[model samples]
Target: MGLRRLAATGVAVAMGGALVCGCGPLGADGASGSSASADAAARALIAEASLSFRYVGDSHVDETMNQQLEIKNATRGSVAPVLAFTALDKNHQEMPQVAVTTVYGSDRGGLVVPYGTSWDTLRFSGPGEHDVADVRVTVRSAAAARIPAGMHDVKTQALDSQGHEISRFERFSAVRLTNEDDFPVSVRIAYILWDQPPKGTTQQAVEVTSVGGLTEVPAHGTSVVQVSADAAAAVARNSNGPAVSIKAYNSQ
Candidate 1:
C-alpha cells in the first residue's frame, strides 16, 4: 500500500477493562496488532499541521512503562519531533530521574516522515507507581532545513540483503540532497577516499568520482543517487571516512 496524509490522530488505552478512551482499543495482550495499522489510524489526523499521537499499546518491563506511540506529523513538510514521558508521583506531582527511550524506524533522527511512516516505541524508565500523566511530542523543522537556507543534508541508512536497516557503524552509506524551498536548486553527490587519516588533525579526504552536472532536485521535491559499491569499499578501507559527501548546485 502507498502512503496517506493524516487528518486526525488519537489515543485509546485499555487494560483488561480499565479504559482511557480514544482511537482503537489496546488488546488484552498489550500488543496493538501491527505498527503499520496503528500508524495508518494516526495518519488520519495529519492535515492539522501539528504533531499528534496515538497510544497503540503499553507493556511493563521490569515494572517500567513501555508505550508504543505512533507520532503523526500532520504538516506539509517534514517534522522532527521530540517525545517525553512525564510520570506523576503519589502526591500527583512530577518526579525526577525519569528516562524515556525512543526507538525510531526512520533514519536515526535524520527526518521524521512528513506524515509519519511508522510507530515509535517509547520505553519510559522507572516504576509505574508514578503513573504517566503525560506524553509530550513537540516538533520542529528537520536538521536538513537548517542547512544555510539553500542547501540540504541528509544521512542514509544502508540495508542488508535481508532488508535489515544498517547504520554508519556498519559501513559507508549514501546521501540525497533535496530541494524543499519555493525556488529550484541543483544537487549532486560524490565519494571521498579517506583510507586511514592521520590522527589528531583535520585534513580533507582525497576526492574520488563525483556524480554531478545534470541532476536537479526540483523545488519541493527530492532526487536520489545510490553510492556505488566502489565508494563503500573505499570508505571501508579508511578507519575514519564517513564515505560520501553531497553537493548542490544552482540552489536559490
Candidate 2:
C-alpha cells in the first residue's frame, strides 16, 4: 500500500481516550466499544502503511516539555507520516495553553523515516505548559517517497560525537556528518540524552533534544553541526556521545 497524505483528517489514535456521555444503560458499553475500536483501528493502520511507536519518554525543561519518540518504519518504502500531538493531563484531558500541534511530512522537505528501521526524534510543547502526564500521538496521514538517489548510495557517519564544556554552566556536542555520496543531500539531526538511572535498576531513562536544521552535505564530503540544550548541557557533553539520528532529503 502507498502512503496517503493525512492532512488534518484523523484515522487512528495511539494514546488517550475520551469520555462518552449518554443517559442510558448502553452508554457504558458503548464507551468501552469505542475505545476498543480505536485501538483496533490504530493497529490496522500500522499494518496497512504506517510507522509504529515503540517508546515515548518525556521530561520538563524550564517551561517546555520535551518528548523523545522512538518511531519504527516497517513498510517497504521510506515514509514520512504527518503526526498530530496532544498533551494530556492526568484526567486524559488536553492541557491548558498547549494546543494540538501538527507536524507535516512531505515528499519535498520533511525528514523521511527509512523503511525497516527505527529512530528517535524530539517534539516540544509550551511556553507556560501545565503538567502533562501523557501525550497523545495520532497518525492523521502519511505519504511515501523514494530515498534520494545519491543518499541511497551513500555511507554516512558521525565524527567527533562527543561533548565538551564551552562555558561555565554550558556545554555543547559537536558532530560532523560525513557523506560519501557523489551528490549533495540535505540533512536534519537529533541528539538523545539520557538521565542516569537509579542505583541497581535496569531501566533506561531518556531525553531527546533537537538542535540542527536542514544542512547541505557536499558530495564525498562532510558538514559540521553543533548542538546544545541548556536543560541537559552537562549530560549532553558528559554522556557517551549521545545517540545521533540523521535523515537525509533530496537537495534539489
Candidate 3:
C-alpha cells in the first residue's frame, strides 16, 4: 500500500476507538478497549513512519568524554537513514567542517548495529522489526575550546535514503565552573560545570543538589565540584554558553 494510504488507514483505525469512547453502551469496558486499540494503532503508525532519532549520553560537562546519537527504524519495513551533525559557536554560528564518524554494532553483534559505517554498511539488513544507528562526532581541541564557552545549542537532523528529512533533535548545554564550598551552584559561573543526574533526566531533580559534601568552606580556602566535559562542549556551541553567580558567605 502507498505510504499515505497506509498512514490514513492507521489514523482512521486509531481514531475509531476515540469516537466510540463516549457514545457506546459498552461503557467502561468499551472505553478501555478503545483506548488499547488506539494505543496499538498509534504504535503501528509510528512504525510506518520508518525512522526516529534520539540523543544519548551525558548532557553535562565534567572531564569525561561521552556523547552519542541514536537513530532507529521501528517500522517492519527496511529503511536507510543518514545523520548530519552540526556544531554551533556561542553566538550560534555554524562551525565549519567538523570531523564526524558513524559506527554500527557492538562487540557481540546482536543486530544492535555499530557506529561509523562506510557507505557499504548502509546496505546491510537491519533487525527484523527494528534497527539502530549510532554516530559519534569528536570536537578537536580547537573546536572544543573555541566552543564559545557558555550556554549553547546543538541540532541534529536525520535523513532517509531518498534524502528526505525524517527527524530533528535539538538540545541545550550550560557550562559553568563550580567549587566545593557551595553545593548548589548557579549555571552562569563557567558554563562548563554540572551536578550529577543532568538537568532534565528522570533523576535530575535528586542529583543536581549536593547532598554529602562539606557544607562550609574555609574563609580563605577553595572547594570544588566536578563538571562534565560533554556538557561544556554543548554549552560552548550555543549562544548563551553558561552563566553562574558567585557569592561568598562567612560561616561563623
Each candidate: what lDDT? 0.39, 0.43, 0.24
lDDT of 3 by residue, 38-87 (tens): 65444434432443444333324442212233334333332222233333
Q: lDDT order of candidates, best first?
A: 2, 1, 3
Model 2 scores what on Cα lDDT? 0.43
Off by over 4 Å in 1: 1-49, 59-66, 88-97, 105-111, 129-134, 138-252
Enumerate residue pairs that collide in model 2: 6-141
lDDT of 3: 0.24
Best by lDDT: 2
Better of 1 and 2 by TM-score: 2
Give the TM-score (vs. native) of candidate 1: 0.31
Q: Residue 161's C-alpha lDDT in candidate 2?
A: 35
Which residue runs does candidate 2 get wrong by more than 4 Å?
Answer: 1-48, 58-66, 100-109, 120-130, 146-175, 179-185, 189-221, 224-252
Model 1, span 74-100: residue lDDT tens: 455554333344433334355455554
Which of the two candidates, 2 or 3, achieves a greater TM-score against the reference?
Answer: 2
